[model samples]
Target: MTRRRSLALRLIVYLAIAQMGGMLLLVPITDFLISASGMAPGWEVAPDDWGEHRIYGLVAGSVTRAETGEAILEPSAALGAYLETNPQARYAAFDCSGVVLRGSSRELVDALGGLDRIRATTLKFKIPGDPDPRARGFLRRAPAASGACAIAAYSYRFAWDDLFAVAALFLTPHSAAVVAPAVLCALAIAWIVVRRGLAPLRSAAADVAAIDVNTLHRRIDVEEAPKEIAPFVEAVNDALTRLNAGMAAQRRFTANAAHELRTPIAIMRAHADNPDDAVFRRDMKRDIRRVQTIVEQLLATARFSMRDACADVDMDLGEAVLAMVADYTPLVIESGRRIEFEPPSEPTIVRADRWALECVVANLLDNALRAEPEGGVIEVRALSTAVVEVVDHGAGVPLAERDKIFEPFWRRDNKSNGTGLGLAISKTLAEQMGGSIGVDATSGGGATFRIGLRKSVVAPPIASFGRVEPQRAEGSVGARRGTA
Candidate 1:
């Protein structure tokens, strides 16, 4: 994955780059302005000479002076002599009245096509250099005499300092000292402002993180967020509101369905009990009982799934477990199974809904009984003040299937007699009460379903009713029990 940079840093980098580009562009702009204003080194203009002309007799006077042995030759002769002395002087000329009075070099005069090419305006000519040819020339009209225009042209090369000056305008020795600190300061200020501006967004994220099914009613503070983000916050709150309504409707449907089915199942059970045929009556009653169990499990699952299902009541863990085991003692006996419950001796209290805990214990015990073979001992032990384990000496759950056993309608064998929701409901109830349930292989054999719960620091009030223990019965069924 590509590493991500913060928005603040990215903004700063972009701004710095833009500033640098702008500064660099200034160099060409400055050069253009200088060139346009006739300030550049090779810039030249033509003078309209309508008065005394200096070049009218310059060539004739120069030849006469050379013959007379004069030190100061005429302008055209002086320029010609200078070119002869300096081979690097590529081009120099003196033009008078549409005629070339004197030429510094024949190459330049030929390139200009005699003197007719020289005009009143500046013109550039390409001249041959040692390595390569470059454009060079400056044209300017000298003072006129007697209606004759005198134009003097010279070739010049740009010096290194000229280029350096243009470059230095954008980047100098102090460029870093000025632009570096300024950009850094701008970035620092921008980061601080941007971070501060996003405070409301950070706060809104925290509030969003804290929201769950229980806090669905709480909405993001739209007013506190910036206007740019307010609309998004409002949309999220609207979605949450819709979600909460849908969840409420679903829960109501489930609860109502379960309640509606329970009454008919109970009535059916009553009718089946009174049937004349013993075989038919027994089969119908068993089927009705299974239906009733499913309905009850559905109701329990729906109840615990609700956000407000947990009741703010402290219940004794040992007492609750013992009571559920006692209630199921007769059922275990009828199934030709033995149950052993070891309740904690001390009062172990936990804050949870009493009904939810009872449902969890009852479901576990029922599962243990169903898994046990005929006359097999099912041990229910409460340990560590807040844990309970139900061990059944039957076929242990396969490792691959243990994770899926608590899912609704998931059964190891598809033909098993139960609705396959007992363990699912039990797991849901345990979690709702801030507890967890899992199954492990027993040391000897079979499977052990362990439940861990949160223990309450505050002890519950003592009830006036005395504790009830499990009673042993005759037959192939028996129970070893205790009470807190």
Candidate 2:
């Protein structure tokens, strides 16, 4: 505001100076032109010729040109003439020899500063015969005379031109007295107008100052906000919308995880209360472990949500699948099921986080091993570019339950001990590792789980075991059961 005021004042000052300066400069120029042009005879002309103009005319009846450069004039005539011509011109009148004109014309000289009081004076000639009393003041006398004088003494009258010059000069200083007040008034008016123009900015600042975090739900109303701030208001509204969505997602994940944990704990509790049956106790322990597996899967899914898939490294898909299959060897034996691991002729490397890749493999194997009937065969195969398939010879998942199986806390059969987060966690981990989990056709019968990871070009050793070495030929000494 101060800067703006200074600018405005500078503009006003420059404009006023330019205008006033132009007007003041014109006075002297006009005076010089009029004087040089001789537009009108000066007030020193003879009375009869000049007529009854009240303020100007030479004095009548008392003048003689001396023979020897001295002007002899009647004091009254010279003084009156000088007084008449310069009503506006200020002066003191003196005689031909510098004596005061007193007595009858005394009032005129008295008004100008009485002659008796005059201590110092300059001399000039006065023409008593001229109509202009102002010019008669110029009359002056020579100190000595000679025969046939070529010069005269006369008193100086105040000419119309001189009067004009005096008036113009005085007005310059006096006019400023009049002009200063008006300029100040105009400046006050300008300040008011500037304040009015800035009112909108002030009001907008007030509105912004009142906003706070607790009031984020409130919107800046268009009627109350300035038009220039509308975009900022819209952006703030959009941010609030995204924040609300993120909060809702967090709430949903928390609720789902809680529900998923309840089923496993309930199953473990049920099994502990049935202690009398040893065979049933063994089955209950298996179910307890299954519940624990599902809980672990939930924890893994939660952990995966906290990070991104960019952490993935290049890994061999065939090797990861075979390793998971071998880890489930005790379960395979306990269930009286045969398992076989098959990989591509070449190593199928994929870009993925290795730990997440292992989790996905482990979950799928758990699911397959749980569902297989006694004496059933489980085949693990790696297709091109990190695609892994786990197939089990059991009743295939119903079409309606396939998607449901990937939801937390859902189960397809009452007899199963699954907390139902295994497939869900596996699906989430696959996606995080830049892969996908889905169902495919089993080789001949049963359910097949397909996991696809990002493909890489590098191949593994030609005859590497990955995780599973070939079992001894079936029915041979110390041969373990296997299925392909």
Candidate 3:
């Protein structure tokens, strides 16, 4: 059933404890300095040994200026009465001419260390005018309002306790004892201030807890946040904004996937009653394949989250492309289309997933086959700088459609036989592998899909390790794979 203290409360309590500890140590030091240092005002004011300040005030008050513009000693009735009642108080004033302005005798004033030289005696000294010849007294000299010198002397019984009482005016006896209650009051006020200060943050946390996919548009009000945490609130709001955009995109993707799946199902349903018809059956199979392609592309998109496609992969680009081309050679021939290969002169080392590399090439080739005219030669080239280009000899893609070709399910021709996800999947896979795919107009009226990957470092061939070219076709360049 214990409550945890907040950071602010903890800090306040710690400082208060430190202050109490300091006071605990300081009181003794001050006491020692007062007793042993002979009344130096290091931690306390100067010692009031024998009421020097009181006598000085009394003597200074009685001296006044006359209406005739001359220094005069006109003791007030109260001062005169005090002097009469208290026989122990002796004071004397002298004019600028060394004449006794207010004294019984000049000899007694000189004996008490007269105003000829003005000074204060910190300790008690022997003096006359008191009943005891060796009475302890304090002597002080002051200046009159009329530029005349004056002196005050008073005697009293000696007591160490009285001396300590006079020196201990800075801190009273219960000074340290008062800290506990003061700290408690301060802690209560601090707790209230801390709670009120964190009110906006608590509200923001509640708002954040309520957020979901549907309510992603809700934003934290920055004005309510304290200035110290305003930037943190703004950063959270920015993350929410990003999440909202991603959710919107995901919603669009889901709607499109549903619509795409619905089309093939509807097409298959329309052909259900005519299975004996050859054209309907062919169309049905094609729709089935289209559905399969959509499902597979969706699966491929899901796989993006399953594994790290950006993992380090090192292999030879030329040898990899050569092997991929060999595998797809039968498909090209079956479709009555010819394919050509042009590998790099040397080992084209590159960093890419071998399966993803082959998959991207397969997608590009599939896209190129659909776009290329019958019997058109599709060219696959692997450059030395870790680049692969798939050039198709067909009507080149228009500049306006090139940008949209890579978007998921985007199609220039809605009636085109193939799904539009090939390029999109290729682009996703390429980006995940730290590569990029783009399309440009081929030099001879076709579209060239370019795939660029990070070039991997490869060791140069030694004199004994010369490159051996494979003799497959005229102008076909291939080499042994080498990588660092």
TM-score of each prediction: 0.44, 0.45, 0.58
The all-Cα superposition gives candidate 1 an RMSD in Å to the true structure of: 19.6
- Please list the residue runs of candidate 2 whose C-alpha ends up more than 4 Å from where it truly belongs after superposition: 1-276, 308-310, 397-420, 457-459, 462-484
Model with the higher lDDT, candidate 1 or 3: 3
- Summarize candidate 1's per-residue lDDT along 375-447 as a digit string, tens digits: 7778887764589889998888989999898876666674575656788788888888899999999888899
Candidate 2 lDDT score relative to the true structure: 0.58
Q: Can you write out model 3's per-residue Cα lDDT over 344-446, one digit (the tens) per residue?
A: 7666678888878887998887778777787777888888777999999888889989889888768777676545667888998898889999999998799
RMSD of each: 19.6, 20.9, 16.4
Full-model lDDT for every candidate: 0.64, 0.58, 0.69
User: TM-score of predicted model 2?
Assistant: 0.45
The CA lDDT at 24 in model 1 is: 65
Q: Which one wins by lDDT: 2 or 3?
A: 3
Maximum-lDDT candidate? 3
Total clashing residue pairs per candidate? 6, 36, 0
Top candidate when judged by TM-score against the true structure: 3
Off by over 4 Å in 3: 1-178, 265-285, 305-309, 400-404, 407-424, 458-484
